[model samples]
Target: MKKDNKCVDINVSANVGECAYSRGSTPIADEGDAVIRVPVELAVLNIRTNLAAKIKFPEPVLEIKDIKKRVQIVQCKLLLPGVAAGTDPFVEGSYHLFIKGYVRKNIQYASPCYNSGVCVNSEMRSLTTDVPFECVVEIAEDDFDRTPQLPFQNARAEFDFFRQQDLGHGYPEKDHFLSSDLSQFHQDSSQFYNQMPYCELISSRITEWDEALDRKPFHNSANWQEGTFETISEKMFLQFTVKVLQNQQVRVTAL
Candidate 1:
């Protein structure tokens, strides 16, 4: 079959599924019950095997030509200092964000063969396993653009000093000393609960480098120049972009 080098195939048109659209912001009161969203930056910790790790290959390989790597997060928990609950008042302070998880790795390597001293790998082998990791990252208060809304407003408190009354039952207080009555004094406190903070994973990126720690001759061949590796050392650089969020009652300015 003869095909022209500059033959036209298809022409695609631009998609205009959405036309002009806009939403008018409604005027809100100075204070109201509402939920606001907050976003922040997040960092991922590095992982390294550090020592020789055993590998049980389905079939022994003469040489590891290449290794493919992947990462998976089985668990992710964020720990903070003075953590606020849904019913706990918000505390303003910079704190650490603790993250814990395991990396799920599927390693595929090229199984090599020797043909007259020329090493060639025609078959690829794979292994799937997990490696656990954990870390603590600092999150400053100004890291995120959106400010956390407070559950309660600062209101002026009104109070008055109590008058001192003569207490016959009490000591003379160093010969006629005046003291305020304590039995009738009372105190009260008002606390408001705020929304608990949480996190959402936005994106993840991982890079890996692996090497064979030890290698031995294949089947102890008399003249074989190829060998197989039973131990591998793995290292990875992982990164993640996550959003720290919390829904809280906030006052809105009419737009």
Candidate 2:
């Protein structure tokens, strides 16, 4: 391999944590034959969107339970070569690290009301059924154990370049969801009722009763009198699956 003088050497290990996972590192050597003991630091990875794939939401429907949240933690090991013993205990040779793992979420919901009152009620509800979605990180020898390098002085510059060159491309600017968008959809009940039949007034009354009985939001409640009905269609459920797989692949390949 073409040696880059700027490269730094270090040792790394992977660990999973709540909300965020970390890869710990310890420096075994440094440039100039200096033995350096670098403190262990966590490697933080982010979940991101896929630029090449399009996420499709099932037609607007009131009744269906979508995946509220899905999170995953994965670990991979790397090995470094060319070590000089008796050097400063802190100094470490360089090593290259590659991470691989799967992250996915499955959202599932029944189709919305096509007919006003014939088969299902009009009150909008969150689908109770879960959509099964999964993302896979194909495990291979390449995922584990790799070379090492010296610590780059300009870590951010190196990281930006590495992300651009090695990781899969980022999502398009338009496709990237803003914080407001996420918060708007996450944990908000108003959005659900708006999609269902009948005005918010009727939906609200029905939801009140449903909450009293189940202590949970009604996913498919048609009206206060109609009770809860299945609103999510099979097609919508499949869409969630596709989203999970596609997103996971995009994240892994990019990393």
Q: Which numbered prediction scores highest in lDDT against the true structure?
A: 1
Per-residue lDDT tens digits of candidate 1, residues 145-202? 4444334432344454656554566667545535555555555545534345566666
lDDT of each: 0.53, 0.28
Any idea what lDDT model 1 has?
0.53
Clashing pairs in 1: none
- TM-score of each prediction: 0.51, 0.25
Backbone clashes, candidate 2: 47
lDDT of 2 by residue, 1-255 (tens): 987885544434544556866985443322343333332231222223221222333344343344543322243333323223223222233323333323243545444445454355343333222223233332233322211232222111111111122223675544533233222222312111111011010110001011111212334545334333322223211111111100000111122
**What is candidate 2's local distance difference test score?**
0.28
How many clashes in candidate 1?
0
